[model samples]
Target: MSEHQPLSVDGQPQQLNQDEATQLAEELKQQIRNGVIPAGDSDSIERMVAGLGDPRGLMRLTFAESLGVVGKAAVPSLCRALSEHDSVTVRRAAAKTLTLIEDPRALPVLLKALLNDPDPVVQGSAVGAMAAVGAEAIDGLLEVLINPNSTAMQLGLASWGLAFVGARAPEALRNAATSDHAEIRCAAIAALGDQIQSLDDSEARGLVEQGLKDSDRDVRAEAATLLGKLHNPAWAAPLLEPMLNDPEGQVRKNAALSLMKLQATASRPALDVRLSQEDQTDVQAVLKLAINQLDQAG
Candidate 1:
C-alpha cells in the first residue's frame, strides 16, 4: 500500500495469468480496495480500463458489468486518465465514474470532457453533470456556450443552465446570434427576447439592430418583438419587410407589433401589404395592434 506502488498492469500478479482476463480484473479491483493505487498510476489504469470494453458493455440499461467492479482508490487515476489517455473508451468510463464518486473536482474535469474528448457519449455525460459545480464553473460553462462547435443541444442546454451557474452571457449571446446551430440560434433569440423586453430603449436598440437580419427566421421574429417592446422607433419599419416576406407567421406578427408600438406611421405602406399576407392568430394580433396604433397616431 505504498503511496507510489506501481500496479502489475501487464497482469503480472501471480494470482492472474496474462490470458485470463477475469483474474486481471479481480486483481485490479482488490488493489484499489486495499488502497494500493499509487500516484501517477493513471497511464496503466487507463490502459486496463480500455481493455475492459465499454463501461456500457453488453448490459443494456445500466453499467452493471464494466464499472461495477472498480473501487474508490481507482477514482483519481480514472479522472486523470480522462485527459491523458488517447482512448475514447477510457475517457468515457472516467467521466461516467465521476458521477459515482461525487468528487467536487469531477464536475470541473467533466467540463473538459464536453469541450475536448474524442467520444460523444462522454461529452453527453459531461453536460449532464453540470449541476455539480462551484461559482467558478459558471465562466467555464459560458466558454462552452461561445464555442460554435459545441452541439446545438449543448448550446441550448447551456443557455438554460446559465440560471444554475448564474452568470450573464453577454458576448456569448451576441456570438450565438450568428451560430450555425438552429437550436442555439433559437435559444439565443429567446434569451435576447426577454432581455430586450425589459431593457431601456437605447440599450434594447443595439440588440434589436444586431438581431434583425439573423439567418434564422424565428430569431428575426423574436428580435422584432423585442424592438417593439423596447419602443426603439427606428427598428419599427425595417422589421416590417420581414413580416411581409417571412414565411413564418410568428415573425410577421412580431414585426407588426413592433411597428405599431413605435407609431411607425411612415411605415404604413409596408405594413398594409404584409397584413394581407398574414392570416394566422399571430398575425391577427398584429392587425389589431396596428389598427390601434394608427388610430392613436391619427
Candidate 2:
C-alpha cells in the first residue's frame, strides 16, 4: 500500500502494511502537532485499532498514541478491541491506548478484562488502564480486592491499582482500611501508604500506624513495609524499631529493611538487640545489614 493510502476501502477499514502504517502514523502526528485532531468516525477508529496488530513494535505504539489523542470518541472501538478482539496483541494495545485516553466510559470493559482475561499481559494492561482512570476506578478495584475468590495475582494488581489512585480517593481508601476483610485491609494499608507518600497525608499516617497493630499478620506486615518505604526517619524509625519484635519473621525483616532505607542511625542499638534474638536466619541477616548500614550512616 502507498504511504498516502486511505485508511479504508469501499466503506470498510483496511489493514495497513508496515510502510503504510508508519507513514500514516507520521502524518497523523504532524497533523496533531499542527492542532488538527484525527477523525473519530467508525472507519477511522477501526483502521487505527487494526494497526494495533502491526508486527512492528513502534508502529503499534504510534497508532495507540494517535488513537489516544482521539480521546473519548475512540472509547467504544477500543473497548470492543480489548474485550472481543481475537488477537492478544490487539487486546493489549487497546488497553494501553485506553490508559492514555483515561476515560471512565471504558471502566466496565476494562474491569471485565482485568477479572476474566486469560492472557496475563491483557489482564495487567487492563488494570493499568483502570489505574489511569484514577478516582473513578477505586470502587471497581476495591471490589476485586475484597472478593474472596480473587487469585493472589489479581489481588496484587488490584492493590497496585488502588495505590496508584489512592491520592484521589483518600476518604474511600480510609474507609476501606477499616474493612472487616483482611484482604481489603491489606490492600487499603498499601493504598494508604501511597497516599502518605504523595500527600504526606497525616490522616493516612495515623491509619498506617493503626494497621501495624492489626490482628492479621499480613496486615501488620504490610503496615511495616509501608512505613519502611516512607522516608520520614523521625516518624518511621520510632514506629518501625518496635516492629522488630513482631511475631512474623517477614514483618521483622521488612521493618529492618525500612529502617535501613530511612538511615535510622539511632535504631542501631535496636537492630543489634534484634539480631541477637532473631531465630529466623533471614530476619537475622537483614537485622545485621540494618546495623551495618546505620554504623556507616554515623
Candidate 3:
C-alpha cells in the first residue's frame, strides 16, 4: 500500500476531496473561534488571510468574518491585506474585517482606502468601516473630504461617515458645510440633520435654516426634511412660505410634508394656493395630505 493512499472509511478507501478540504477549513475556523490563536502564530494568521482570497465567494466571506473572531492577533495580517493585496476582493474583504474588529489601529489604512482606492466598492466598504469606528475616525475622514484630489463620491462617503458619527462630529461637519465645493457643502448640510438632538436649539435651527436658503436645491430639500424632524412650530411659516414657492418640486413636497408635521394651520391658505399651481402629481398628493393634516389639527 502506498504511504499516500487515501484513508479508509468503514473499510473502504476514501479519496481526499474538495469536501474534505472544506470541512477541514471549517474546523480550523471553529478552532480559532474557540481561542486557539496562540501568540506568534503567524502561519495560522497567514493561512486565514490567504483564505480570504478563496475562489468561492462564501468561503471568502466566511474568512473575512472569522478575522474578527481571531481578534487583535488578526489585525496585522488584515491590515497588510487591506494595503498590499493585489486583489480588490481580498482588499475589500480585509477592509470589512477590520471594521468588524473595530480596532482604532486600522483607521489609517481605512482612510487611505477611502480616499485613494481605484475601486469604488473598496472605497465604499472603507467608508462603512470608518463609520463603524465612529468619532475616533472623524479627523482622518474629514481630511479626506477636504483633500483637493478626492472624488465627488469619496467626499460624499466621507460626509456619510461623519454623519454616522453624529453629535460627536459637529466641528468637522460645520467646517465642511462651508466648503467651496457644492457637493461637500450639501453633504455636510445633510449630515447635520443626524446631529439635531445633540445640538443646542439655536445651533440646530441656524444650520438647518441656512441650508433652507442654500442655492442648491438638494440642500434646500434636506433642510426642509430636517426642519420637519425638529417639529418646532415657530419656524413653520418660514418653511411653508418660501419653500412652497421654490422651483424644485422635491423641495416644495418636502416643505408641505414639514408643514404637515408642524400641523401649521397658518400654512393652509398658502398651501391651497400652491396646490392650484403645483404641476407634479407627487407634490400635489403631498400638498393635499398636508392640507388634510392641518384641517384635522384645527
lDDT of 2 by residue, 1-298 (tens): 0122221112333467878777888888888889898888988888898899899898898789889889988888888888877889999999999999988878888888999989889989999999998777887898898777888888889988988777776887888899898888898998786678777788888889999899999999999888877778999989998899999998998899999989889888888889888889888888888888888889
Q: For residues 1-298, what per-residue lDDT tens digits would candidate 3 score against the true structure?
A: 0112221112211122445437746876677678674333656666667777667778777666666777767877777777777888778888888888877777777787887789998998888887886667767776776688988898778877878875665676777677666666666777776566665545656777878888988888877877787666786566557799899999999899988887778878999999999889999999999999899999
- The TM-score values for the models, in the order shown, are 0.42, 0.83, 0.67
For model 2, give the 10-residue run with minimal summed lDDT. Answer: 1-10
TM-score of 3: 0.67
lDDT of 2 at 8: 15
TM-score of 2: 0.83
Q: How far out, in Å, is residue 186 in model 1?
A: 7.6
Q: Relative to the true structure, how large is the alpha-carbon lDDT of every model?
A: 0.56, 0.85, 0.74
Estimate candidate 1's RMSD in Å.
11.0
Better of 1 and 3 by TM-score: 3
State the displacement of the C-alpha of residue 267, model 3, in Å, after optimal TM-score superposition.
1.3
For model 3, the local distance difference test gives 0.74
Which pairs of residues collide in candidate 1? none
- Which digits, one per residue and each the tens of the lDDT, describe model 1 over residues 127-204? 555543434344556667767688766665566654333224345455555567655555555556444444432443
